[model samples]
Target: MYQGIYGSSKKHESDLDHVINRAFKSGVEKIINTAGTHQETIQALELCSKYENLYTTCGYHPTRCNELNESNEDEILKQMIDLCEKNAEKIVAIGEFGLDYERTQFCGIDQQKRYFEFQLKHLISLKKPLFLHNRASSQDLYDILYKYRDEIKAGGVIHSFDGTLDEALQFIQLGYFIGLNGCSMKIQNNLDVIKQIPLNKILVETDAPWCGIKQSHASYSHMNTQFTSELVKKEKWIAGKMVKDRNEPCTIIQICEVIHSIRDKKESFDELCETIYLNTKHLFFSDQ
Candidate 1:
């Protein structure tokens, strides 16, 4: 909810309340608002205060790693620690952080790695589960996390995962969960990797305002149902109606539906949903 439905700016600010309420009406029980910068984390905390079920993460995203440097690194990291300590109850994770080589143009490789490790070393004390991100930099990400495996007591999730089966297994073997979203199910290979991951190691998310499932995606054909909300262009925005092509938490049902369709038939949809729900609770909401 930090950005408007369009995601690039605050053009659709008025529609946010309706969008969140719609998600609840559509059966989404909780949401974890991920932040990529200090300011965004503050905004997320503000939003979380407004909704009891809404929680958040605090850290710099790999693409946004350029914001950190030797000059401000200590100050920024201190701010992150302060935010986590102050909002420990609401801050469930210490990321949206990790390496992202696919978009290294935003931040060079050295800068990304330096700051990513900086946060890992500095924030591990929070002992909160991580909300990780990885894209085309799985090897580096795994290597870094593997080094700190013993220190990461609360474990983490490789959110928006779009990696191979081996990569997924490696992370799971490290006691991390694999988060799947529209982006994770875009291709046939994505579906194949997801199919092999055990149910207990999987967590589904919307990655809203982005990663909306498309008809062209391999998993689209497997969806047995669709979100019934009427889709309208952002320019033609209407209250209670969804923006065209912009993902929201309400559509998370489709993610579960697609997974159920692709996964083994031995487990019924209800059973699969229960297993995933419990897995999520174990990782992110264990305190509750």
Candidate 2:
């Protein structure tokens, strides 16, 4: 099992440590983190190195590409590249890299695109799997991905998935696996998406410190005919549940619980464990 911190929104310090330790106790032997910045990467590496199971994924997040200051862009990129090369054995992937139009606090599309392409080329050369991020930029992202689909034949997931069934089908066609997280359980539409997704193509994540599933307080919010109502409710629940609890990696068990509830099989745990384990290995360990 994978068991390291996620480099998304900042998780509570104690919670982060709790998740890592709990996962370690539960027999998780590896984890892929998205250290979206250089400092964050270094800190996580320092904290998690004691555990032989922990690993890191370093890159700028789609929404945080603006954090890549113009003056420091080249230097930061070089540092990231060097870190990846130096710790190639420890850093398994190069991402949380993609496009996010949902939040414009970051740079414009062009800048995001530039860094994304740069990282793609870098990882392709390294022949590593990606820990991707894409939200509200699926079409454009898909278009760009298709161009390099063959050249960057090593595939990755669109993390914290929020795309349509058709869009997901397109990704599968391109040899990408879909990442299902707590959002999958809290969001009913994603629940529909989850049911339809092939067992072999699904992987689970918490995206913790964010995207927590709020099953307890959100079970009965009324909704309009449009799915938008439910989507909003779900997003709120995911955020509230995760953050309210300090959002840690060990919450992966909560993620599994939600998945089990949706699939409605008492045996979901065993099946899910086996399928997700195999799926993760198939994607990340194919070359191994």
Best by TM-score: 1
Question: Model 1: per-residue lDDT, tens digit, 1-288?
Answer: 324534455555576788789889888899998899989999999989999889999999999999988899999888889989999998999988999888989999999999899999989999999999898999999999999989999999999999999999999999999999999999999988888999999999999988989999999998876764588777766677787788889888888888998886659999998999999999999978
Model 1 poorest 10 in a row by lDDT: 1-10
lDDT of 1 at 119: 95
Model 2 TM-score, all chains together: 0.80
List the lowest-lDDT window of 10 residues for candidate 2. Answer: 219-228
List the candidate 2 regions with Cα displacement exceeding 4 Å: 1-16, 69-72, 216-244, 264-268, 285-288
Which prediction has the highest lDDT against the true structure? 1
User: How high is each candidate's TM-score?
Assistant: 0.96, 0.80
lDDT of each prediction vs. the true structure?
0.89, 0.68
For all candidates, what are the clash counts? 0, 2
